[model samples]
Target chain A: MPTKKGTASGGTRRTPATGSRAANQRADAQRNRAKILAGTVTAISRNPDASVADIAAEAGVGRVTLYGHFQNRAELIEAALMDSLERGEDVLSEVPLDGEAAAAFQRLVASSWVLVDQSRALLAAAQKELPAARIRELHENAEARMRGLLLRGQREGAFRVDLPVSWLLTTTHVVMNGASEEVRIGRLDPEDAPRFIDAILLPAFTQKRDR
Target chain B: MPTKKGTASGGTRRTPATGSRAANQRADAQRNRAKILAGTVTAISRNPDASVADIAAEAGVGRVTLYGHFQNRAELIEAALMDSLERGEDVLSEVPLDGEAAAAFQRLVASSWVLVDQSRALLAAAQKELPAARIRELHENAEARMRGLLLRGQREGAFRVDLPVSWLLTTTHVVMNGASEEVRIGRLDPEDAPRFIDAILLPAFTQKRDR
Candidate 1:
């Protein structure tokens, strides 16, 4: 995460004052773009069909400034999705995954559930606007992180070896999203989600008695 | 599973020959309606957006005859879904549940998965034309059947009791639907699904070591 300014504008600067002004303008543009993306995430999370004007108002910027950063609604939603995933990656990468594989997996679930709950609506919005394959491509890093952990858990004998690791991974996600729906329909309490997730998953991944 | 003919036309009989002719006509109407419903299932399963003409051709009936049974597409899809669920109920009620819980549960999954795989697309089509609550209402028998098995399994200590039975049932569906997608993507073999489902669910429902 280093910021590298474009060199296209760098070559035209001459006086020190002009260069300093250009740097300040670049910083302003960068901040506006970040605000618009962040605002898009919040607006869409609250309402998937949120209008562009709502996003601009949420970001406290003009509609022109919003369009200046993103060419259209799809571009804005995609960038918002990317922003949310990057934030998720930052959080998921820091969870301590060093204990027993089961414990580590639950911890991962506990941390990731909140992120998934927040981003799932936005993800659905993105699906309506983008190709399904592109959506899957954007999700590669997060999927790999979770898939790697499931593989490790299975190999260490902490997870069931009778089922394929891919199946395990797929069901794990399904369980989380199921909880999201449960909460949506008022069948489950949101505050109790992490514990509910762990309760279902920890037992689910353990060895089968028949084996 | 007994057939109840309408009493509206029951009292309109006159002479013996006329009564016989009326009964034959009733039987013919019943047969044609059954064919249309069966044809709708096949047509929708093959293509959810299948038209009235497609369904009529599949059922080998004329459009007028098809309309004679169903007032419109929504009514037809609803009838088709009911037909499927009733067929499923017939098969499921015969699955022996007198054995150990885990074995019985697997037996249930193996039998129901085929019905689900065949009817899911048709269900999706029903969902589009029908209210969601109505759709859920239509699925009550299937859900109740599965829920009863899970409850018995948990009560007998053959299935994990750490999670709520409702959560267990919801995730059971998610896993089945997940497998469908996996098969659709060509990642898993279609013939291997039952074994795959049993492998996932048996391990998933076993008690955890910590508990």
Candidate 2:
């Protein structure tokens, strides 16, 4: 016999007591998408130039299932990259940037270190595979956000305005990239790496104040 | 009939009485060696992970000839990496560091920009493939050299002593790596990247005279 109007075959399947089944389907789709992206991250971490088949195999899914989600290797790689970036943005949004620019800078560096250490391989692959134009776009957006903070500090007389905002943004990216490389290569312990970042970057970004 | 002292040929058989023939052979060998190195540079510049077969194909030389000269891929790659490092060491050696510390810092940045820009791909590959111990050995030597200059500057009271010598080395490496990436992706002109390096690095390494 058929099931009830919203219930499924399972005796305990929570169905649309009020369209909850539709919500459950949506959650399942989101979970599947997350799984595919996670697999892509794993595959590309192993080999930056990994092909779509490699990603599919890692996900334990067929080529058609992979293609149904991502059209090609570039798309899959782009999605993986953007997913990491989006996660970074989310993390940064939660970080408080109040008080002295130096304090804010340290917090930012620490948070970034955590994110970079977690996704080191995927980040390296993105750098390798992403096109120049795409990188410029992403970098510019990040710079703008960072510059806004630096500008605020400058207006508050907490940062030196003699240096160009762009230079600060560029330099921060440089240090962060280096720290990430150190983490990836095991040159710096993931925990100790943040201390290095704090030591080097805080001094570079901080304005001198009378002690 | 025997020609000269050793062969059954009628004419002089083109054997020089002087050392010209041996000198000519030496010159030819040098020319072939240079060509092979140039080919290796090109191959590594394009693909740091390129195989010995790939280098041979790019160099337009037979596999036998390639192996006859280098013996194996590791030897050839090491030679290539060493050649690049020697060029950098030469640049470091020639820069006049006796003047103002900041001026000397600028010179270091300028020189490194040129070397790093040319061999970014090779550097990336070396980092990926070479044993970490060897890389650390070379890095330590470079650091010792930089440390001497930094110590000299600090003694002269023209530089900050708050940052460790290792931090300075890390900064320089980060700046070089950042500039190399910018050059590789065509975001910054090769000529213009040195200026970017100078702008970011000189200030970090220098005592803020204005402040």
Candidate 3:
């Protein structure tokens, strides 16, 4: 079957040749957008107070192009934070949730370790740059997802029901935040961080079972 | 009887004394000590950069007297941190560990609320005024106690067994550190603070129950 040709003149219509070229341009633009965003995030992570000019310089994009992608500072920061969270969420989602509750809990703690370890600077910048209202909004979304998973585990009798799901989620953050600080200061060997996690988180989340 | 004669000299020790009496003198000195400490703590909380002279003025003591109590800025700040941690430990110790695990957990979380709350200013000063090595030393002591409680709870079959107790204990600080920033800016309600504690801590520590 022959494809319909573009309508001429009055309306803007693209021929198949033009459409294919447009798709390639769109893909190239998307790649550029990703690079600019990544560059901005890295700059801000390095310096919480980094300006748009600095970000543009790092990305090798003009100020106009940077603004074209992000309308303002808050918008740029928000996008960066969202991107980081999305990455963290992807990691957490992939963690195997099946097993004894204790085992599952360990996986959860370990996953947090990975997230915090990787995103320490970015997370710190988010904490510094975002307003509390925005931070709370972001936190609430994460908390909801975490609580749902934990509650399911609890309901399945793999996790404890006595403690509130919210608390457990907060506790996970606390462990990672504290451990990250230690790692940053060289007080903790990065490789040994998991042991620190095990010593405290394992005991807190695990149920007593005969060895 | 012989009481009047006893009161003449030796009995003066037990009696409530006034004016230039030794007991009155001791009481006045004790009050002065407390006033100075309270003043220093308040000033430091508001601005850790406050000088010893400023702290003395706030405490209603002479600069010389402030120096008499603390050798220098480092000593004063260290003492203040220690005092804060001591109060924190006292609060944790007061939680009834012997009660039902859930009830005990609730009490612990509630008690911890104030500790977490007070830590904002303390941590800010710590980040600025204290060395990382010094902070780690303090954290180690605090973690030791927290770890014991978590282990005890696990052994009692009250807590889950998967995550590390160390991770749970450290994460409590992260939640506080993260949440305190929100609370300070009024973006998060102070009353709702407990929900944060409940969300992460309870799940991390409690065992899966039938409920």
TM-score of chain B of each: 0.84, 0.75, 0.72
Q: List the candidate numbers ranked by DockQ, top first.
A: 1, 2, 3
Most DockQ-accurate candidate? 1
Q: What would the per-residue lDDT of candidate 2 be over residues A156-211, giving only the tens digit for each residue?
A: 87766656565666678788777777666666566767776655555555565642
Q: What is the TM-score of each candidate against the true structure?
A: 0.71, 0.65, 0.53
Please provide, for model 1 over A41-86, each residue's C-alpha lDDT reduced to its tens digit, 9 standing for 90 to 100.
7888788778899999988899999999988888998898888888
Number of clashing pairs, model 1?
0
Better of 2 and 3 by DockQ: 2
Name the candidate, 1 or 3, with the larger lDDT value: 1
- Tell me what fraction of the real C-alpha contacts between chains A and B each candidate also makes: 0.52, 0.26, 0.39
Q: Check candidate 2 and list the clashing pairs.
A: none
In model 1, which runs have C-alpha deviations exceeding 4 angstroms? A1-79, A124-132, A208-210, B1-83, B123-134, B208-210
- The best candidate by lDDT is 1
Best by TM-score, which number? 1
The CAPRI-style docking tier of model 1 reads: acceptable
lDDT of 2: 0.70
Q: Estimate every model's Cα lDDT from 0 to 1.
A: 0.80, 0.70, 0.67
Chain A TM-score per candidate?
0.85, 0.78, 0.76
> In model 1 chain A, which range of ten residues has the least summed lDDT?
A1-10
